[model samples]
Target chain A: MEQKSNKSLWWVVGLVVVVIAIYFAATGSPNPSSVAGKTVKIGFVAPLSGDAAVLGQEMQKIALYRVKQINEAAGENGTKFEVVYEDGKCAGNDAVNAFQKLTSIDGVKFIIGGLCSSETMSMAPLADQSQVLVLSPGSSNPKIEGIGKYTLSLSYSDKKTGEDLAKALSSYKKVAVITEQNEYNIGIRDTFLEDIKNYPSVSVVANETFPKGTSDFRSTLEKVRQASPDAVLLNPNPGVTAENLIRQLAEMKAWTGYKLFGQLAYLLDSGRAPAGNFTEGMIVIDAPNVNSPELLAIEEAINKDQGGTLNDLGHYYTASTLDAVDLITSLITKDGNDAEKVLNDLSRGRFKGHIGDIAFDGHNFVRITLSGKYLIQNGKAVLQSEQ
Target chain B: MVQILIYSFVMGTQVLLLALALFLVYSVSKVQNFALGAIGAGIAYALYFSISAHLQIVWTILLTIGVSVVLGIINFLLNERLTRKQEHLFALLTSFSFAIVLESLISIVFGTDGKNIIPGILPVYEFGVFQIPIPGLITICFGVMIAVLLFFFVHFTPWGRMLRAIAENSFSAESSGVDSKKVRFLVYIVGSFIAGAIGILAGLNTALTPTMGFQLIIMAFIAFLVGGVSDIRGTVIASYLVVLIPETIIGSLEGVSLNWKMVLVFAVASILLGLRPNGLFVRESRKS
Candidate 1:
């Protein structure tokens, strides 16, 4: 009985080896191109949890929705795409691990995300080392401009938003700054401070940095108010913290003299809703609204699936993530799962999608950007001008 | 300076409420019920939603109490199981795990976004250079009331003595016919109620967060160690010390921002602990 069981096991092992050998021989490679009617696995890394979870969840929904659209459009016998998601937690260390696992273990040649700047910057080295192409949909850290050959960001640089914001505040003599001590906020703050130097009339009277999760910023607001600035730049992480700061600052009736300015975070209606009308008239400098009939229609579908990501996270991220998915899937549909070709085409090609006609143009990051001026008018953000 | 001082005390009161919650459970169970923060957060969310549903204030308060009691019962069971075996570390771990689970549930239910129990700009009263929000004033009043009441209860009342006796030595207290099991259960119930009230106040004061209790619990624990863990009086003083010291240091310094606030507080705590290992007011036991 033991001898018969051993013979049966050997037969099964031999049959598995033969099947795998035949599969490789028939496909001529371990992973066949999309053109050959094979499934392509794409890795997605995003916050998925932590403070930036809303953004990450929205990005994930967008990716999954877009992939589903592509798969549906592809039809039977066409190349199907599968997305393997890993929670980056919006931290550098966590992103590196996610990137490593995706590249080494999952054998994913292409990955989208590390939406937060820290995630993108940290994964750049590993992505380059593993020869995997990383396309970031939402990271805007100016430092990410030339992160790596394999890493490319579709999102606008903080340098553009900062300079635009500084230019917007050029009329003010005394500007107070309250920056959240995080990668994304730090990037915007440093850039804004540097650009504000261009205007000799402006002087940052109060520059304060608060740690993440500092809910009680009443003292921070009081300190900033004491500076007596004509304009105050509220540079904090988006969502809850930003809403908290705006509300706390607005609570002091006497602290209403200064004009409030924010970055991409101000574009979010959900973030500002808690403070009610407090955030009205606040100027925001970031990506201009990425509106297109095609994207708008897709966003509606995604909102149905994710409940309210498009409305909660707003347009910039949703548009960028949609464009990212379109960019990669198009590249996969054309050149197959070749990371080298994808990187090359991504850098040089002017791919038209949700965020308009854009490309990297031989640069590590995209050359085209929609960073512009926006104002909160009557409890809703309106694009004032496309800079 | 006045405004900074006002805000510091406001934050100090929040830490004090959390410390008292910790002290209540620690007194009898001899285990750090870290879930007190999550319990506070969970109950706060419960109250906020109940109020949002347009329930009457009385019903909302009653619902909040019911939720708090249920949460307290769950927390009691979690600690009671391990604490009976005198597994203090395991009890702490179990409570910590419960804290994580509760926070995750809150996040799942409410999302990570901050919700305002009272939306828009809060009303504030001016006292010369200091502008104090109504909630802050209320918090300060309540903090003092609870601290004074707790101090009196533990030092003067029979029930308080029973609680303290169990805190010192549960086995001996039990041997002396103290009904320690019942007392510990009662302490957990009271502790959960306190946690729930603090949660509501904190949610009203600061933007409600899923991890609000987690942050408060850490601060309370530090104060618990800094003040003597054996007594509520020590915890009260240490809460003010831990909160005020960092606020003052950050306010006074030019380069040091609120980013370094926690680091400074931790350093100050380390130094304080170094000076008094058993805590500020806890004296060394004389073995004669």
Candidate 2:
């Protein structure tokens, strides 16, 4: 009996030790030399391989290019940067897992990314607790404004886009709206409805909400068609959902006679939506980069190197991502790895970005001084008016 | 109201195709084939691949239907092998695992970004107050034809009567010279073939996503349960009721949200099932 007990005790001890070793191995720390003043490790979380991969890939390419240029121009005492790319997959749970891996395993204090709103929102609480600075290039959900002091965005909030969309559709007395259920889209929808209420002349006749990844809008479109609204507002993330909605609307014959209005996602120009009568005459409200000659030239050069046009979807996002890299690099150079100080410096500093003067308000949202209501004519986005 | 009815018919037909396919397998094999959706999705992806290669639409669909038959045979063979080992739980899980594997393979080959099977917009047919897309109209017609053919085959044909015999008592049917294995195999093939047709119609109307069929199966099961799991005919009737009433209600009401359509479906199914545990249309004395 004594010998049997001893054997079981030995097995238990071995199993515990094995488990401990596995845990440490799975979450092992980065090499100390990588962050010991030799390099600035910036953690990145983006949808690298999923449905939203096109935007993430573009952001990645632009960030890397900007980093290379910055590092090449730096003198002695300038820190070389290393970006640890984690695939967020544009979902909340995946973003949290990626965030934990970067902060705990990589020990990265400064992070850039979470291109999608769901990605950033999931990482916000953790970033706040760890005092890690998170500067997102594309998350525009208004709810993100209060996530954390450490959380900031380089793009304008969805509030502005929603208001702009409402104003553009004010001429139509009765309008139908189909919105995807996502943090960013929900924010845009709430604000758009709120703003549209200001114009009593406009009344929303039909409103429908579908879950993310929904492709069939036939029944919903039928509902909208039954209402015979003057216009239709389609708020879908830029990709398959948007294209499917447009194609199906055309199928239902609901595409005709309805003035189409969309948020910035439509302006990505991803080629997912075919260039024809369906896309023609559609008006999109997005941040303006039409007046930025210098940035446009840089984007042209990058596209040449990329061997593909990367800025088909709003070039403003690519520009913002590059600016984020530049801003982080400069902040680190000035404040040396202190996340709080770097964030403070970022808030105080003003810089000229591709989309015009880049400055954040007290809540860390970028202020938009330039925007455009673009007209889709002959498959190309033409600037109709600048605001 | 006419527009709502037309839209309901189109949408309900789409659901019925999947439900009846599930019903066919369940009645004979006593196995809830979760992979039915994945089988259809895989064939749809094949159709997309063929179209992308510039094949004619007719050739693409025919080729994909061929692929569906092969997949159905493989699924049934695997179930048969597993059942022989008395691994009922494993057989059931195999259906789910098969679906995941198929979806993963699709994601790898076609990519996570969804594809539009049709190259361009399809025109709509308008008559009086009703407007229906060409694809939607075709789907309704195909749905009716398949349902009628299935109903007649099950009620009047010898092979189908043997299938019913196997469903009632497999051991007795086997002893009476009914080839139970052959009947099950045929059921899977026919079911999967119809699944393939529905998949192509759905892909044409909406778009193709790796996870497209997952939600569809949920809706199909809801119809299955509501119509009485054992009665394919009842399930077919319930499918239209399940999709149409809620959709039309949500479509016509000004303030009602589209998201509630599923909720209404779930609620209707729950109420019907609670009142009739054997199924709203299922006779307690029926064998299946």
Candidate 3:
């Protein structure tokens, strides 16, 4: 009786181990849905509620609109494209959580967005480990390019934006620089300084670094005003610094003859400063505007379909998401359920996108023209003459 | 130097808020309420929404405090139910879980996007080389006021003495006809409310993000650990010292990244914790 019981127990344990092994084998790897008739899931992650929520919501809206349009135009193998929204919150740990959730719960074949660079940085390692394809819509940090073979950025580097700004301001003799001391701001400042080194005629009159979320600018502005440069280049986000700095500059009567230039950080439309008049005559280097004929058509169609106009920043995210969907669909059509094949196809081809043309180099870095300088005139941002 | 001082003060205010919450709960319940961070974050979210909807700051602050009180009461009741006969570890786990739930709830409601409280800058007051913002000054004032009130309540009030008794020996206080459970609930509510109000102040000073509370909580924990978790004065002083040391050093370290400073802080804290397990100001055990 004891021998029989021992044999029965061994058999049960063996059966359980086999079942567990089978489960792990079936679920551990990335498996594409039925390529013939099932709905294709495209995952999107963004900061939807914290300090960056406004931008994230805008991105989500645009992405959803684009997915709707894609599904309407060409049903992928008689299947519709569905977007699964994941909240990244633009933080490291949160981005990882969102990535895991999307990969596990939604079973997304392709993913778009990881809006902030920090978030992209955090998700990159996991994406590589999971063999998941991720295309960042607005992650411009140079560090992201080295993350993995599957990660790609639609946005250009800070270096490119800085170079564009330097070219735009080549005619100016003296320039003052004010930048926040955060990574993003520092990246732009360092790039701008490096690029400006090439211009012998321009002198950096004053340079000041302030903390991120700094609420007051009078002292910094006073220091900059004392230097009395022909132009002031600020690398802080437009939220508080731009509004207050501009207002203070106007109050100090420093805006009369001086030109103000900023990076894409000053592109937010707070509706407080209408037409960027306080910022008028200001030059900024940013992602290409969605005001072109093709973009306008797409925006119009999106608004008609979604019942609202996409914000300026939202358009870029929308374009990136659409491009990502197109790339993924094309890949899956060519080779079903093979992550390697999909990655190879994405790396090998050049795709035309709403933002511009996109082609990945041998290093898996997507080469895209995302740097352009625009002039803020009478509260409107117009492409610079050179651009 | 002035900028660093101002930033330090602002950072100190957040630290004090967290320290005070920890102090209050530890003094009355003999259990550290780790949910202080969640309370603060929830209040911040409430304040942000209220301000965005065109409500006055005063009213927003009031609403935030109210929400925090509600959360604290719920936490107390739930903790009481779960930890009635369990070990201290159970209470700690329960509070930790509560914090997670609150954080996740905020995430679900607010979405993952970080919202800036207000996008405009406060005008700076310049006094030669000494420059500061009116908002930063207000935060300092708020911190001081809360600390003063807390001091008076703990030292002068009869209820405070009863709370002290309960913290010293819950069974003895209960045998003396004091309702230890009620005192625990009151302490939690008051502590959480203070944390919540400070959260609003923090949101005003910087930007409001869901995870902003996480950093502040760590700083607060450090302050509590350094100052002696049982002593309010010690905690407050430790909070300011912790913030000031880092700010002063980081300001002096030109071209050395902030990440290096954070690493240094962690290393120092690990050493300090090793040397002084009960913190700088160890509380005397009455029964012993």
Candidate 4:
């Protein structure tokens, strides 16, 4: 019995030693929690392996490019940066886990990430309590504005987009709205409904909402088809869910001579391509048009690191990511590593970015780059210069 | 009304194919076969990869079927011992864990994005006011043919009798010299093949995601439960009911959306089961 106990004790000790070794090996650093002077460790949370990974991955590449430029400008003896990446999977639970790991385990005071609104919203309460400065590159939900004092977004809110969409749709006599029950979608939805009241001639024929992860929309589509609306607004989040919605809607070859309006989902070719020509001439309401030759050149240059498919979605997100890196790093450089102080100065600071000018109002959302409308032509949402 | 029927049947046939696979596996193993969903998803990835590789159509079909057989064998190996020992709860857990493992592995290999089997707009067949895509038509014909053939096999053939006998009483059937192990293995392989074929068709009809199998299997589970687990024909009826009830209710109602669809389906199924506990087609005798 004594010998058996001894053997089990040795096994436990061996397992612990192996776990410690793996911890050191995986982190690939000497004491990951400790950052030497002149080196800034920033935590990055993004959907590196889910339906929305394309967007997150592109933001990551742009972020890395910006970091490289900053570090090179800083020189070898100057303040260098290291980013610790965690996969948020575009879900709330996973984002919370990533945030906890980055804050508690990796010991990061600054986090740049969580491109999806769901990811950013989930990590807000924790960041507020922990005093970790979280700067989201592209989370656009209006609810994100007041979520936390420490949390801030480079992307503009969906509130402006919602009103912009209503104004664009004011000419239509009838409109049907189909929205996904998600934070970002709901933000736009509530605002759009409220603003649609301004258009007395435009009446909503059918108002529908579906839960997330719902792939089959045959019944919803059929019912929407029956409503005989002049315009149908497809409001699903960008990813597999959006693709599924448009694909199913296309499969039911009934909607002809009807206008299709969407948000981020239809604005990206990857999300709308599954619907084929069915989405042609559709109008997409999303971030402002940042398709200048200068922006396009930067987009192509940054996307080269990601096999050049990163811009398949759009270039506005790239601009936002560059501005986020610039804003956060500059704040940290001017102000010390104090997260609260950095966050405070960040709200007041304004700088020129790829999207032109960047500034934040009392609300944490960036006040620059209002939403724009695009007309889908030849399977792409071209910027409607008129809008 | 005709349009609703067309839509329901188009969706129903795919669910029927999935439910039939579930029923076939349950008839032999006496387990819920939760892994059926992941297996379908794995095969979907296989088809996507094959298409991406630009393989010949015949080779792609054969490779997909071949992957299905291999997946079936792996599933059988994972659960065979527990099932033989009659540890059904453990076997069910094993199958469930297998599903998780397969889903995680696929997500790691292929990522969780949706992929299209046929990337362009599919041609639609118009019957008056109803429009059914080519894939939907193929699913209907193939699903109906498979269902009829399976019905004949389960009701008329000797192998199906062995399956029924084993399902009814495995020990007794084994004592009567029935090789229950071989029959179960064969059933699992066949069931997986059916799942893989149906998975390809379903992906072609819509889009392929790692979680699609779980969504499909849920409908199949509801169908098989509402009908009779032991009766395939009953499952067929229940499949259509599960889809049509919600489709009809949500379609006709002015304010109702698709969110209420699952609620309406469950309510109707509960009411149906309350009336006929044995199932829609199952006729159980009550002894005085």
Top candidate when judged by DockQ against the true structure = 1
- lDDT, candidates in the order shown: 0.86, 0.81, 0.71, 0.84
Of candidate 1 chain B, the 10-residue stretch with the lowest lDDT total is B248-257
Q: What TM-score would you give candidate 2 relative to the actual structure? A: 0.88
Order of the predicted models by TM-score, top scorer first? 1, 4, 2, 3
Tens digit of per-residue lDDT, candidate 3, span B1-288: 565667577778878878898888877655667888888888889878887888887887678777887888888876775444645677777787888888888878876444556555444556665555555677888898989888888779998789778777788999999998788888888877888877777766555656667677777888888777666777887788777676666555544333344555666567656666666666444575
Interface CA root-mean-square deviation for model 2:
2.2
TM-score of each candidate? 0.92, 0.88, 0.76, 0.91
DockQ of each: 0.54, 0.38, 0.10, 0.42
What TM-score should be assigned to candidate 4? 0.91
For candidate 1, the C-alpha RMSD (Å) to the true structure equals 7.5
Which residues of candidate 2, in runs, are more than 4 Å off?
Answer: A1-40, A49-51, A67-78, A254-256, B56-63, B85-87, B285-288
**Per-residue alpha-carbon lDDT of candidate 1 for residues B154-247, written as tens digits (9 for 90 to 100):** 8999999999899888899999999988988888888998888788888889778899999998998999989988867789989999999989
> In terms of docking quality, how is candidate 1 classified?
medium
Tens-place lDDT per residue, model 2, A1-387, is: 999999999999999999989988998744333323467789988887566777787787787778877777775556788888888888899999999999999999988989989999989999889999888998988888877888889877888888888999999999878998888788889989999999999999888888777777777887787678998888877777877877777666534677888877678666426434777888988776543677777787778766577754467887888788988987787677789888888777788776567777557677775567888887777888877
State each candidate's chain A TM-score: 0.89, 0.87, 0.79, 0.86
Q: TM-score of the A chain in candidate 3?
A: 0.79
Q: What lDDT score is found at residue A349 in candidate 2? A: 71
